[model samples]
Target chain A: MRPGISKILAACAAWGDKTAFLDCSGASLSFAQLHELSLRLGTAFRHMLKGATGRPIAVVADRSVRCIPVLLGAALSGSFYVPLDGSLPEARRRAMLAAIQPELVVGLAEGTSEAGFRYISVDELYGTLPDADELPPVDGDMPLYGIFTSGSTGFSKLVLKSYAALMSFIKAYIETFGFSERDVLGSQIPFSFDASTKDLYTPLACGASTLIIDKGYFAQPGRLAELLRDQRVTSIVWVPSALSMLSRFGVLGHISLPDLKRVLFVGEQMPVRQLNIWREALPDALFANLYGVSENAGNCLYHVVEKSYGEDERIPLGKPFPGTQVLLLDEAGAIIPPDQPDLQGELCIGGEILALSYYNDPEATASKFVPGPPGVGRIYHTGDLARYDEAGDLVFCSRRDHQIKLHGYRIELGDIECAALACPGVDAACCLFDPGKKKLTLCYAGASGEAALRTHLKGALPAYMAPGSLVRLEKMPLNANGKTDRVALARRYCGGGDVP
Target chain B: MIESNAMKEQIISILQDILPGEDVTESTTLADDGRIDSLAVVELVTEFSIAFDVEIPFSDLVNENFNSAEAMEAMILRLQQGT
Candidate 1:
């Protein structure tokens, strides 16, 4: 099959005059403009690389239209893009940069960037040359993009995905969903998140346009509803948490989103309570629960909410996409037969969905990516636990580890604790998430006051990773082995109170 | 409306109770600074409605009104005076 960038090339040929992207600020990029800019940036990268290719190019992913072209351009020139959230703590971004050691660093559209990395701009990319006659030949095996996710050790983990894997998933997703030139996808997911790729590339594959909804509009559900209606948005593939927030804000009934047809969600489990609200509001809309990770392009499992269920019932994780295989491996690494209904096993993903490896992390790559049972290919051991329901769909169970998914972000509790311990005057720390309250409460025993720790956390972790509220104690409760007693701490402070 | 300082003090006291361990200054940027989320906004609005006996409508829940204590108080005053 063709390489990942070829999809854009084909789109440029088919729908050059069509609007490919429309930013919330009323800025629009036609397919022709996107193609021309991508070519220019590719030529610029060629000049920068001189002869080098297959290098990592870091792009500070501030909310801007320039970011899309910059990413595709990097691939056009035979290099991969690493999209970073500009709002991340400098120290955290620095750690991520250190891991990738990107060939070039950039902030394409007034993108917020830090020092120590020689940065470039989109204008400079356009200035490279008038035009490049041809792009470098690329293979499906070539790295497409490497994305960083939260790590248990406080260091971000860069998961590198190949163009082949991305291409396969995108093709399957678009074909299955039947996205077309008539569809206007409302983009909400951040570029840093793997799922954002679905919103970015669906247009290229099917000649649709994506409305770059303002990130700030998420907190203001009324504005979000207004924008979706104004833009005539037909589809939305976003994290369930953001959808939950809008549902919680009660904006659906007030605003009419007649054109919004598809509501696809991934990242975390969509709360049935929140799902019901959306379902009730948009009675005719197709609501689907997508399941996958950064290891894949976006998702492999797609479950359409065709049937109604109680607010307490779960929406299944559904069957795999075309050409993808899913397995339930028991403790002995044997595949749990499909007929074994009530037994839970660790979910293993295989086929074209597997990523190349974790960038700069050999042990992590080795431990998670392993050979599958018998005819199945090498699989990625998703730390998530799953069970087969009577409907024959995979039902998600709890995670095997302490990693918790909050507001569509997968956070390792230890990462927060590690960052807290590094702060001045912090003796011991424990972070917990009350899913019901949707709050991250960090409890720390330290000489530093609440405000000081808050500042430190703000500068160290992303806003989602940072605890919304803090609980300070003179000393931490200890367990038998002299470890921080998380149970005692949870019992005292995290009992569903305001502090909790 | 009651005296400005007394009303502001009452708001601050309620905010502190809702968002403990946070330094709620007079000029604190609530929504803009990302200090307050939808949940916090809901809680604060509930408390303000109980204390001030004024219903803060959803339309008044924009960032400008919820940005600071003064902004919050101004909105409360408008709602109290039936503006």
Candidate 2:
């Protein structure tokens, strides 16, 4: 058996009848049940392997109790898993599926069909158990999963993670949190996001119960609060937007949840305004801010909130996780001297958790994942501009790319331009994010009002990308860098308002 | 009895409240007519569910049921009756 898979299966066995998963739809599975079912599913997948050992199996399941076992089942069967968010648009979903053409697509919902792929639903796999004695043995540094990240250029690239890396990340996470079998975890991120890795895997590894909430519930913060109360969830890992919405709508204040202990927020900056509300609401909870990208497997940095946070203090993204090394390097790739607070550089992460490379996109892999100084080996260029403060905490700055994150969704400026060019009235357009309102404002040289342009954009882009305000500009302002001066644009439209 | 015109006006008012910036009217189609996107529709549905006490399924979220303020009011009435 593969070393990681063997250890996880043994952990499941050791914790025997403990609850392993709680599907929000009212289904619960115990660790013993999960182990047996995983073995059966592994044997079933082995029969379908068609002699292609170590090949990845793509999974397109929503957040459910069945997702973890299916992942473990794939690992035990000597295959990897690639998760695709089924909620995405068909075109985007097809693009991702095509990039990582897998041996099988598992756990699709009824009447939902994607063309040009063979699939088996979870219902089919668990209907009958194969003889457990005949389960296949897993071996070697075979991949455990291939998680895709948005490419620096246009397309998305898959990052194949070895079983060793996955296990190492899981080990670090378990040790950091001191998680045990008694904890009940609440998962809010989609199965596709890297944040869900901890949500889905950590609980099963510790034989704890993971409560999978439906994505639709995320839009309604009230329902999310109700789910937390009803599920008796002891821990939660979610994006800051979810917490912000919860606090804004008073759901956190009104809800009565006595069991919640650990609250982990990531995927965006956690404003102190929002954190203050959370601190008051869940006075006993251990609130943690995690920082990382998909390239580092999962989180690489974490900061636990202090009991007595000063009013003037900005929350620091504390030191790196175990087995990870962080460095602040200038544009020339020289490491900045430690204790130099004024030195701002790109955040470069190096460690065991760094992804191997972008799948099939060597040019991009070379550009971002470059070799570090002589003895340091390869490091991931985070592209995030950051500087160490006098206190040794990393303070994040704007991205080198004009990628703007509004409401936790990453928006590339190029995507807005492409969408705008598709519109009828637009000759040329540039969209800028007003951080104050968390709104996208479209400044165009063409004839279109806020209404007409909004109507046009609704057809071209997703709801979030549609401009909230339209500003007409005779010509776009460009800086010395020959790029559109976004700072000038912000000054023009924002008009000295406080930036969000 | 809630008059048909009053129901439409009430629905439009609710939509206007939910989508703060827009100038929504009785003729505004929430979907393909492009007055609103999926996120706005979700917001409208949540408000409608709370105000009228009906559960709207995610799969049933389509342009046909919410083309106009009148259509949304009619859908809400239908849902209320079915319950």
Candidate 3:
């Protein structure tokens, strides 16, 4: 059996009264406060929920101390939480709400009400009282939380994670990275994404402090630099885009972060051109590349930048974390020989840290998560391509499918095509991604122009999902299979043809 | 000194190059209108820095400075005078 998340939070509270979290505005919560607040909120949730467990509770995850308790309260109430970004487009937000079908929507403060769903404020949850301080019994196998990731099916996929998976990965992460109460973490990613889980939970698990940097700081790298220096943030686990933005703006050259020790980046490939800029600025800081999918609880592989890489060299994906097994298999499901460094195969992850499943989508769950050969049990078949390097380190090659990562958000080309197809006057649509330019282009055989299609896409998709360019095609190229020839479309649109 | 109207026209030309087919006017709110995202902003910074021979500091990257073509021209003029 595994220990529940409630027990972990209680233990962290008992550890010490160190600061657990602080938002960009300097508002904070101590460990004791976090525990106390969560308990109070959880008591209210227990009263509201009664005996119902594992029910998805949607939380408006704004950068407030109250949201932390709201999330914890869901866990304490024997229910899992799903954090929704307050800034999401209405259509997209409605799509997620429709998918989750949440019974309760937790808001940060009072006067929070949506049309259909019952809305309850986190503050109200804290204010209201239940007779007892006790929480409902919880099992470690129970779902702890669910986070939405990009789905090839156009709709966002809610990946449900269990308490066991989270705790196991947290333990591995903390142990591998040598994090303790002495360290101060600077938050980067928003609470809506899985990357933010590391920032939010690390403090609770390690009894350390977390400084939540403001989202606006990203736009102004100088302000971000100021926060880094002001907070004395020792470690920051961020996405490559965030780090790259700072390097691109040349902010690292202007500022100094003396206390910063560990610089961890994940989500997308770190451009060597930008990584070198960071290395030159913070020579002493240990830069590391982490690789994982939201389908897995967190990161599975990590590589410390021990040596200098050339400006164009692709960094190695590195070895698996403790207890995690990474396998590379060819299209025929046969294991690729490790010694053959040149042989590329799809990356497969097998471990306890794997997510329970995509919430309420067993079809998708079955499609990706399959039983491994004999003893390996269940393994998540990642569509990411990989190859072993000369040093036996796992190196990333290219994506096996049309799935792409732009600005650290995973996107599927199929999803874009689906959105484009849904638009009126659209007959055929193909989305092509230019990796080097980080630009998305659309080639469509349609009556709708760029503006019309863009307007339709704005309603259907998020800002990042919107195509940078749209071109009209008299007819779509088809392969021998009679399917839309995406490669030919990409070559025509992304390579040279500027068919406006 | 180049006339302010000419500078504004040049700025509009640059905006047109960065964001094709968008209505970029003097009163247009670039950020609110969703014309200048992070990627476009980066390109704008590079373009504006080179076009105006002025370094666009990250501090000056706020919405007020880049919300309109007129705003961008004013900023360029101010930076040109080393103010």
The digit string of per-residue lDDT tens for model 2 on A361-391 reads 7887889787888788789888877777777
Predicted model with the maximum TM-score:
3
Cα TM-score of candidate 2:
0.73
User: For model 1, how does the per-residue alpha-carbon lDDT over A1-500 read when each residue is reduced to its tens digit?
Assistant: 56567555655656878999989778888888888888888878877887578788998886677788899888888888899876665777787788788888878554545576768877766776536565677777878899876443234578888888887888899888888999999988778888889888888878899988766676667777888898899999977757866675567777889999999998766766678889999999999999997677768788999887654356889889997888999999999977889797998899986789888789989987888998888898888788898878898765666568888887767668766766765645788777777777899864567889888888888888988788976445543222356666766767742221
Best of the two (1, 3) by DockQ: 3
Per-residue lDDT over B15-74 for candidate 1, one digit per residue giving the tens place of the 0 to 100 score = 776566777766557778666655466556656766787876656667788778888888
Cα deviation in Å at residue A498, candidate 2?
26
Of the two candidates 1 and 2, the one with more favorable lDDT, higher being better, is 1
Instruction: State residue A380's C-alpha deviation in candidate 1, in Å.
Output: 0.8
lDDT of 3 by residue, B31-79 (tens): 6445565546666676666566788877777777878998888888988
- After TM-score superposition, the amount by which residue A103's alpha carbon in candidate 3 deviates from its true location, in angstroms, is 1.2
Candidate ranking under DockQ, highest first, comes to: 3, 1, 2
Q: Report DockQ per prediction, comma-separated.
A: 0.18, 0.10, 0.21
For candidate 1, the per-residue lDDT at B52 reads 84
Winner on TM-score between 1 and 2 is 1
**Model 3: per-residue Cα lDDT over A456-482, one tens digit each:** 899888899899999976456654222
lDDT of 3: 0.79
Question: What RMSD does model 3 have?
Answer: 9.9
**Considering lDDT, where higher is better, how would the candidates rank from best to worst?**
3, 1, 2
